[model samples]
Target: MVVKSEFEKLGLPTISVELGEVELEKEITENQKETLLKNLQDLGFDLLDDKKSKTIEKIKNLIVDLVHHKNSELKINLSDYLASNLNQDYNTLSNLFSEIENTTIEKYFISQKIEKVKELLIYNELSLSEIADLLNYSNVAHLSNQFKKITGFTPTSFKQSKDKTRIQIENL
Candidate 1:
């Protein structure tokens, strides 16, 4: 809504606006682009102009959405899901993501999942088994192993400890 309002305030006709993307009725002028960029920056949003950067951001957004928003388990593999959504080959997407982000897509996805696990642990509303099931892990053991590998804290230990540390999704 903020993005849409910004465009409307600038007298730009937008066909649609979604997270990380916007479709305008027509091309925006250089001045309009500059104004939009400035406005978005003021709102803590960066306008990604490069195709590679945009694609990378899209990938990150999709993974974040999948882990944080969707309640159902992923029926297909991550690569297939990403390729189908982005209309690009998995290898190409993986290569581009790795080159730019200095991390594999799998690693990034795991990091997001770990962040979600941290959040769930902090909430203390679900058991480890429930969290594993909710996150589509094979079992509590698997979740515990991965959680320990990434965070150096077993889920139980993290939950029991005085300080519970969680990283921001964007920082991952």
Candidate 2:
């Protein structure tokens, strides 16, 4: 069984969850690694090299954790965090992410944040002020502004439209 903690060294901050054991004594072969890599590539991420793939995976994990976990308070300033955590200059990391992902890291970060806001809106647990605080926005107004900018509708409008259409996570 592969312990969840085994992924700790990958360096994306994650809460320890009680993942049940799933035993597989067989070691992953080179071909299996290639196949896994191919699957990830098919999902829109281009795996350039093992080192790049690892770095990209770390970024993906952080983004997903930020969006999917309500209790997760992600450091909103991703550039500074990425620079320090990945041990690279912000410019370098941003450039590589933009080059390979064909989108700026800031755009990706904002997209993830907006997705999270959508999820919160769906849950109807937190008020706009609370959601803004949770997401580390300057204020509810700021959150609404950004949310409206990325998505055509205002937060309130988005909430109203929820019954009509729910946005899917993968589409974001």
Candidate 3:
């Protein structure tokens, strides 16, 4: 009842609402759902449908998985891998991602990789060369160049800076 009332206040036409202890399920027709989503977007909120949001979430998970499990020795090409796994063409995914996120997927991927590099650097467990190898960079030089370009500091300098900060993965 409360949920339905709230939807009504938003000028939304609710079909049904189910309240659960841990989750809420709202059954809305496609047109009504799209209308509500458009309203949210007009209010400066992103309205990603289940399919689109799930695709983005899967991409995020894949990045994390590659970082944690693959350690940057990612064998599969990103476009081919994403397309095959998500059952969508890379171009479509890329376009949708850019339209929604306001950034290219490749940039997001690079940012995540740089974050992992920061993590490894903070641990002080691996040499720069080793870190490069672990992250699948061609060499320390390439990693240093990319790191400097992304963070505006050399890897060594970044490691030494007392206030080096990295954005959280989820926040990115």
TM-score of each: 0.94, 0.67, 0.70
Best by TM-score: 1
Put down candidate 3 lDDT per residue, 11-130, tens digits, no spaces: 665455542111224556777667756765665444444677767767776766776568744656878877887788999999988887899888888888899899999999999998
Candidate achieving the largest lDDT: 1
> Candidate 2 at residue 137, lDDT?
83
Instruction: Return whichever of 2 and 3 wins on lDDT.
Output: 3
**Model 2: residues with Cα > 4 Å off, grouped in runs:** 1-49, 67-76, 162-172
Off by over 4 Å in 3: 1-49
20-111: candidate 2 lDDT, tens digit per residue: 21223344566654664465455553334456656665665556565567334564467776777668888987777777788887788788
Worst 10 residues of 1 by lDDT: 67-76
Superposed on all Cα atoms, model 3 deviates from the true structure by an RMSD in Å of 7.2
Q: Put down candidate 1 lDDT per residue, 121-146, tens digits, no spaces.
A: 99999989999999989999999999
lDDT of each: 0.92, 0.67, 0.76
